[model samples]
Target chain A: MIGKLNRNSTLLSSIISIILGMLVGAIAMLLSGYDPISAYGALFSSVFGSASDMGETLRTITPLIFAGLAVALAFRTGMFNIGVEGQLVIGSLAAAFVGLKLELPPVLHAIVALVVGALAGAIWALIPGLLKAIRGVHEVIVCIMMNWIALFLSNYMVGKVLSNNSDSTEKIHPSASIRVDFLTDMFDGARVHLGLILAILTTIFVYVLLFRTKLGYELRAVGLNPDASEYAGMSVKRNIILSMMISGGIAGLAGAVELLGTSEYLAINPSLPGTGFDGIAVALLGANTPIGVVLSSMLFGGLFNGGSNMQYVAEVPFEVIRIVFAAIILFVAANFVKQLGNRKNRKKKGEKASA
Target chain B: MLSTMTNLLETTILYSTPLILAALGGLFSERSGVINIGLEGLMTIGAFTSAVVAINTGSPWIGLLAGIVAGILLALIHAVATVTFNADQTVSGVAINFLAAGLAVYLVKALYDGAGQTPVVESKFTDLAIPVLKDIPLIGDPLFNTSPITYIALILVFVSYFVLYRTPFGMRLRAVGEHPHATETAGVSVVKMRYVAVLISGALAAIGGATLSTSIGSEFSATTVAGQGFIAIAALIFGKWKPFGVLGAAAFFGFSVALSLTGQVWGLTEYVPSEILTMLPYVLTILALAGFVGRANAPAAIGKLYERGSR
Candidate 1:
């Protein structure tokens, strides 16, 4: 269904979804006896308020884009990798382990840590993807279960292997850090790093990988119709695993950047870091396009970054932003515009159904 | 040793009540042809309302009722979006979760002067040993010495089974999920059935959350429900959409959770790492799904949109 839309209509529908989401948010604010205008004003200024704020916002957007792409890639392959959060956790743990424990030179160290993290993520996803391919198990259930498993495993990692604190590990080596000193100084002490550049490069790479390559065509074809693709001599099972692994790698990158670039250490938490579920919203909102994923994640990044300011400046709670995003996703999911288009093409689709 | 066994059983029953309730909730919704990953959201709303109302009214019953109503109200959005608007059910479910989560914290903050959690409620249910049954041996203690909600939940599985397999409504609801087109041709309103099922799903799942807040825990916090709703969904699938199957699955999961913490169940904790023990339920769930049980067969049209006149 996502593949059916032209680029322009996809953009138009997304804009409509965002508008609807904002309208719902405004109404929620008003009904709560809060001024929506002031809340929105605070939200705007929160991102544009200062150079540091802008840096933080960019940093926030980076992980979301990676997570969104992870979701979008699987979504395009007719798979729902609900385990992106699990993948992220494993990846982050791996990257943190490498960054903190291993001693190597600057650039090579970071690269090795990143590669290991992405591989960890891929391995984490491999379970569900293989199950889906070989045993016909639905990815949703396994992925959801894997999320809790990841939490426990990461907690153990933090507690046992790298416990400088009860709930957190020691910081990574500076050589393995992604944050550039020049960038930090430019942003007035912001911890914003080159992760945004990595995210953008990934976006471009994936866009090419998914659209411009024959392998991309094969992956998408399996997603659109696996039986037909198989009839066309494509190995459906292999493609499913391959797509899932690639998506898992990207999701791992999200965690790697988050830890290596932002936290520089791992923390043991009872809950997920939460990007996987949000990735579902980002991918849906972005219409599952690479460029769209980046754009939509920026919107999410801005909302999340601005939420505290909204709370402080307008006396509205930060959670109100979740409501807005939820509304946007609903609008996008219930795309009446797509229905209108579907109605127009029904004759062709109906004939094909019969044929 | 017998007493220790009984205590473990009691803990399992207490923990399993919410899972059983929530899985049954999933049973109703999925059997009616609508996907409801929003059980977590519904439970959250239920839990928050239950906690708040219990605090204000000093009556757990009223709070519980109010929680159910809140869940039903929130579920109405899901019903409208999926049945009325033909929205993607999974996406709609995700939205429902976001709405519930945001609304819960948002309201808590608004009501409590920016406090992150609710104060403990004194009126919540406490564990009870049934008068007649308490006199019985080890078996009776395990079976009866539990939260009253556990007994209600135990009875509910049979009730759910009867309702799903015995009643005319059950047949139509199943038909609606499996083949809405056929159900429609038989002069039944697929939309109405889905709405009823979803509301019931919301109510039960909410009660599950309320059970956690009011009975198991002393208060409502963001993490109180934790991922129990998702666990309930896993139980639903693990149970293969059957009430009795879900009861057993939930009990097993609850047992895993209950024993994993203390390692008193066969003293496994002595040998196993606490982390490994904690990971047991999820790992076991995956193994169960991948093993001889094979794939869980959902309703034929579980995730598909049911258009009235279109194929």
Candidate 2:
């Protein structure tokens, strides 16, 4: 497999994977005695039901976009940052701490909280990156361990250090909140905030960083062929650590955005957040590209938003979305349509090979 | 203090059984040139199967068998995808984890009148005390007076060590992982070896799940297999992929888990928060890999797709 996928081939494979995933999900629903049509109908219809629905859908998409970008960046840099869940929680904790404890001007408070949160996530990721670069430890093993540590540490801090008489911290000060009153009014009181605008801006920023910058070129070169990059006088270790920190920063930003714009506080989480895990599927489906991640996140965000509707209308658990995504991931991995890609490329003067 | 030590040892052995079983399973797959990160998913399915079957049939033994069969079926998918189609093993593994996590809970809800967890099975493994062994002052109670599964798991470690190191099949398995092309030239069917290894890996990992549900945990829930599958992987790395080493590593992890709880009783929680205490196993895993153990000595051909054309 080459380091990057050809656009035409990737588009075809992604479509086929989504179709196959839906088919399998349908079969599963039928076997379970649930009505697949009604369930799926309820899922999408809910996303388009009203202005409020649209706003809520945007809210769901916000964190996923950040998460997808985080995963995509790491994928581009030849590392699997599965510790995103840990980083996100730690970032949220940091943001909540900042938002609650600090006093600052309205614009400055939110900005400062966001920066601190992203830095928290970056620091969490730095450990595994450093270990992989310096000690030759597998990043996956260390990341998985860190996920648990992050969870427990955050859980302790949330319940003991941050609790304001209940399971969650007190709502953040209004100065630190990213809630946009005009957007809220337009969406009929839905909690749509500045996070969506931030998401789109970040996507464009990632595109420019990866495609039009010297550092991005060096980082991806190291990812594709570390030995060759090292021979070319690039510092592979430094690149590895740098990319991990950036990926982690985005992951932290995801947590920070959700805390500031939506949840507005931190709660005791019993399990690792699924959004961090979902980033893997998003990146893979997007072919690890910036713009592609936004599109993929949009699709996933719709499915997830409609999940509650599926529960209410068709009596199916929202978890079916996970199963469908899992199947899609499997199909993507198998690359069943690679032959199609190969055949199409054969007639071209310069054909790109695929994984 | 001796009594406390014995109690702690008892808890350690009690908890380590599942890790020993799962890590041993991981050894087989990695030894045959496949990376099986789906141990968590396989265990989740196993835990679900055993819980459901045991609740229905009133026999944990039958439940255990069904769990194993379920694991083999799921592993066949992994084998076909990764071994036959050359899919990325890690991708396949991540897919399996999500699939199992969602499916088991969904099925439980469907089968149990919308309940989120399986009803606790009435037919559970009873703790046993080997008569004479149980009488030995300190070691006996801690080591011998526990579930029968613990004894079987300990015995299997030596059995696994012998099978991997001394037996012809074991040698062939290791050879494929180390040098599949050489093994292919020598007339061993690399594909068949890998398929067998992956399937065995699934079965043993399932047993680990079964141990949790029927032998120890008593029920299947969304959190039943939680992160035990991942912990088993850490144990595999800590053990350095050797059978005896794996056994020791699994035991060490189990001790960490047990100590997380027992330390509270001993007033150690006064210094360390309970949540921090619970993080011991995970933290130790990272620490060991980073500096204490240095690099992991993974099999040479692990995570690589063996293309017959290249061979």
Top lDDT: which candidate number? 1
How well docked is model 1, in DockQ terms? 0.71
Across A1-355, the per-residue lDDT of candidate 1 in tens digits comes to 5655567787887787788789898998888788999999999998968989888888889899999999999999999888999999999999999998899999999999999999999999998999999988878788889989999999988987788437898889999999998999888887899888999999998999999999999999999999999999999999999999999999998899899999998887978878998999999988798988998999999999998788988899998899998888887888856766777699789999999
Runs of candidate 1 with Cα error greater than 4 angstroms are A1-6, A336-355, B139-142, B264-267, B293-295
Residue B30 local lDDT, model 2 = 91
Q: List the residue pairs that clash in candidate 1.
A: none
Tell me the docking grade of candidate 2. medium
**Model 1 chain A, poorest ten-residue lDDT window?**
A1-10
Best TM-score among the predictions, by candidate number: 1
Clashing pairs in 2: none
Per-candidate interface DockQ score: 0.71, 0.68
**Candidate 2 regions off by >4 Å?**
A1-5, A164-167, A339-355, B1-3
